[model samples]
Target: METITTFGPLTPAAEIAAAFPSSVQGKNIIVTGVSPNSLGLATADAFACQSPANLIVTGRSYDKVEASITSLRSKYPNIQYHALIMDLASQSSVRDAAAKINQDDKIPTIDILVNNAGVMAIPALTLSEDGIETTFATNHLGHFLFTNLILPKIIKAAQRSSTPTRIINVTSFGHQFSPVRFSDINFSKRAADLPTAERPDLEKTEFFTGSSHAEDTYYGFFSYAQSKTANILFSVALNQRLWAQYGIASFAVHPGAVGTNINRHATPSEIEQALKRAAELGFDAASKTPEQGANSSVLAAVDPGLSLVDVAADEVTGVYIADCRVDDANVARFATNGHLAEKLWSLSEGLVQQKFE
Candidate 1:
């Protein structure tokens, strides 16, 4: 594996694949939330061009998954593509998808798993079929269960391969908006009423909770932020538990701001307001093309420069990648808290009624 000296925020995914072709060649990669114009599709397309053994794409809709795979097959005819219908909000759906992958004869091992599917800023407080908050369930818990269920395959791939098997959680810079509200994860309690310790940043609380803190004041972005924070924590705990023992490296990636349908739940006015808040936090909030947005994830998945050995040796809090490089300054302190990561891992296990060792 070769290393690149520099990669900018606007670096193209193709350039990453070209830089480390061996990292992707003959590897089995799975990317969730892939549709025609989604960031997941862009990531998959990058891997496809590099001659991966299998490019498995997943989404909630069969039509969308089929369309994405069809388009990719047309352009990269030599590559193999598999479509799995997975509704990340539903635990049952995630289980079925993972089971299929494990039972499928063609998918012997999973070299890369990109937990890229997610919903953002859902305007209302919706619940999944399992009765958990929709945003949290879809963005964090769903991927949690799915990844754990598929651990066998990922570990198997790592055992046979020289390069580490990678798991990329597509998180966001929006994680700065809020930490995981452990006490009020579902936001059943008012953010203002939570203990001061629970609400670490009062200003951020006011931003997401609003001044009123009314009972019905459900801030969609707050829930989205909490889930994104969970994504990073999950990666932290995952890497800690699996890196040295199983040769698996996990990364949380902020794929810049890409124009995609993840915001379909938000109205134009809401989007405008969110942008204003983002600017206040000193974030660029500039939009990138799907291809460019996929760069960070592509880099996290294949860049030989990243070392799980170093992460394990240092016992670093967590690894958060942005703009195709390790950029921890942008991550919220709570997102990288090792204790929080362990707590989240336990909570996730209890919620899913299963444990991954």
Candidate 2:
């Protein structure tokens, strides 16, 4: 049994970014889901202190966007900040935001794109405006569409720059709960959860794939896990394309157990139940502070260790990061399947009705 390991008391993102001043100085970076207190804000805030030429923060509401920008501006007056209105559940909103970002004259290039905004299990079956499952749409499809649309600016930044630009996807270990479901990727087909005792196959294989893992009784936990798996696979696919074409890099990180408002949509009963389950799994007491949890994301974004000449030799792009370090095989086997990643990419392009690759 792989015992659940308690990730450490990590160095805060501010401390980590201070060590690598050259990496972020005078660069353009964008972080999504930058509410008052979030992993995304912490990541962007750390870089802001380093005097980035442009730091963009985005959220679903204009009020949250302005509030975050206001708060960060108070702390780092020297940093140039921009706010964008984005709603990950709507493909049209994502496209509009991307178009606005691309046309901004002040933000000519994109040095880093941190896909850090995500929603947790809402404990219900809700669909986005595009008819896709809400959890899957916000967590995976939105970032997929956003990245493809903004990749040109990223490529431009990398081509005429001294360092490689990055696309960072903040995923989670819940990805181990399931794999990409090819037959019922959207949860439109067979949807139901089987009791653990009844599903003997689940006992044999620690991780199960496909619609078999979805909720028949509306088990939102599994739904969130499946969406997270999509995040990892997308990072794998995007990493391949970025490296081959633009000499850029993409990475995914399991930003260790953090206390945040991602569970805002969960009902009180659902929240209590989740806490109880986390306690049973030894995950509750092991949680890191929001700032500490943001360390892995900051590390993935700008760590001198990742810029070594030997980094590419190790194929660091497709790997997953945890505890502020990259681990070769911490992710499930399916996450590394190139063919499957490509298939998911194709499915994602179809969902958004746009093809940028």
Work out the TM-score per prediction.
0.93, 0.85
**Model 2 misplacement above 4 A:** 1-9, 189-217, 266-285, 307-318
lDDT of 1: 0.85
lDDT of each: 0.85, 0.74
Model 1: runs farther than 4 Å from truth? 1-3, 200-202, 205-217, 276-282, 309-318
Clashing pairs for predicted structure model 1, backbone only: none
- Ten consecutive residues with minimal summed lDDT in candidate 1? 309-318
What is candidate 1's lDDT per residue for 1-357, written digit by digit as tens? 223658888988888887888889999999999998999999999999999999999999999999999989998999888989999999999999999999998989999999999999888898899989999999999999999999999999999998658999999988887788888777777767776545535465457344323344467877888899999988998888888788788999999878898989877766666667777878777789999999989988887678552343333543888887787667887888778888899989988999788
lDDT of 2 at 251: 73
Give one clash count per candidate, in the order shown: 0, 2
lDDT of 2 by residue, 81-179 (tens): 888899999999999999999999999999988999999877677889999888889999999998889888999998977854788888887676567
- Worst 10-residue lDDT window, candidate 2: 197-206
Highest-scoring model, TM-score: 1
